[model samples]
Target: MDEQLKEQLVLEATRMLDKAYVPYSKFPVGAALLTKNGQVYGGCNIENASYGLSNCAERTAVFKAVSDGNTSFDYLVVTGNTDHPISPCGACRQVLAEFCDADMPVLLTNRKGNIKETTVAGLLPGAFQSGDMV
Candidate 1:
């Protein structure tokens, strides 16, 4: 992705941090997904009373894009409050593999402006996909 776009995505993700609904862990997370067609979608983590029902920011952004009829994605940016960058959870990685190419870029960032870049395959080596079940 271009530097300009990447910066924009990071900014958007960072801005979304304020919108996270974290009444439990109190760790706010935000995600921004850039579509292949140049559209960007942002999402903030939302917590529920039932821990199992809580949704990660990454999945929220991905689902939003998918719901809007978008499947192809260029990259994803996630922001959190740690000093170092924060990566997506296991569930989010699986969901990403379901819709994104293995080589898709996953950018992690922290409130301190630190960034770490990885790919979907890097996060989930030998990830289980639908074809594997066939």
Candidate 2:
């Protein structure tokens, strides 16, 4: 992905983090996804009293896109307040793989304005897919 596009997506994730509804862990997270057609979607983490019901930022963004008739995405940007780049949760990673290519761009970043870019395959090596089951 282009540097400009990566920066833009990371900005969106950072902004969404400000609106995160995290009460339990108090660790806010946000994600921004760029669709193949160039549209962007963002999501903020939401926590619930029943922790199991808590939703990750990445999945929330993808869910919103799917609900809006989008199935494939080109890039995903994730942001949080940590030293190292934040990787997507297992569930979110699987969801992304289901609708995207293994080489899809995944930009991870922290609040200090540092970014680490990698592909879906890098983070989730040998990630399970439908074809793998059969």
Candidate 3:
């Protein structure tokens, strides 16, 4: 993605931080997924008492986009309240690998304005795909 669009996506993810429903860990995370057709969907992490039922911001955004018929994505931006950029968790990486292209760009950002650029393949090398199972 272009620098301007990446900035815009980061801002959208940052804005979503306030919408997170974090009570246990108190760590708010936001994610923005940009579709191949120029659509952006933002999501915030929602914490649950059971913890296992809680969804990550990245998954939430992906789920929302998929639900709206936007499975193909170009870029994804994630933001958190830390000094350094925060990458997605293992589960989020697997979920992303399921829907995103191997070379899809993923941008990680922090409240301190730090940003890191990485790709889905970089995040999850040798990822298992549907074809592998078949």
* Model 2 C-alpha lDDT per residue in residues 20-107, reported as the tens digit of each score: 9987899999999999999999999999999999999998999999999998899999999998888888888888888778999898
Worst 10 residues of 1 by lDDT: 1-10
lDDT of 3 by residue, 1-134 (tens): 68899899999999999999999999999999999999999999999999999999999999999999998999999999987999999999999999999999899999899988999999999998998976
Clashing pairs in 1: none
Candidate 2 Cα outliers beyond 4 Å, as residue runs: none
Alpha carbon lDDT of each predicted model: 0.94, 0.90, 0.94
Model 2 TM: 0.94
* Residue pairs in clash, model 3: none
Among these predictions, the greatest lDDT belongs to 3
lDDT of 1 by residue, 22-134 (tens): 99999999999999999999999999999999999999999999999999999999999997999889999899999999999999999998999999999899999999987
Q: Rate residue 76 of model 1 by lDDT.
A: 94
- Assess the local accuracy of residue 2 in candidate 2 as a C-alpha lDDT between 0 and 100: 87
- On TM-score, who's better, 1 or 2? 1
* Candidate 2 local distance difference test against the native: 0.90
For each candidate in turn, the TM-score is: 0.97, 0.94, 0.97
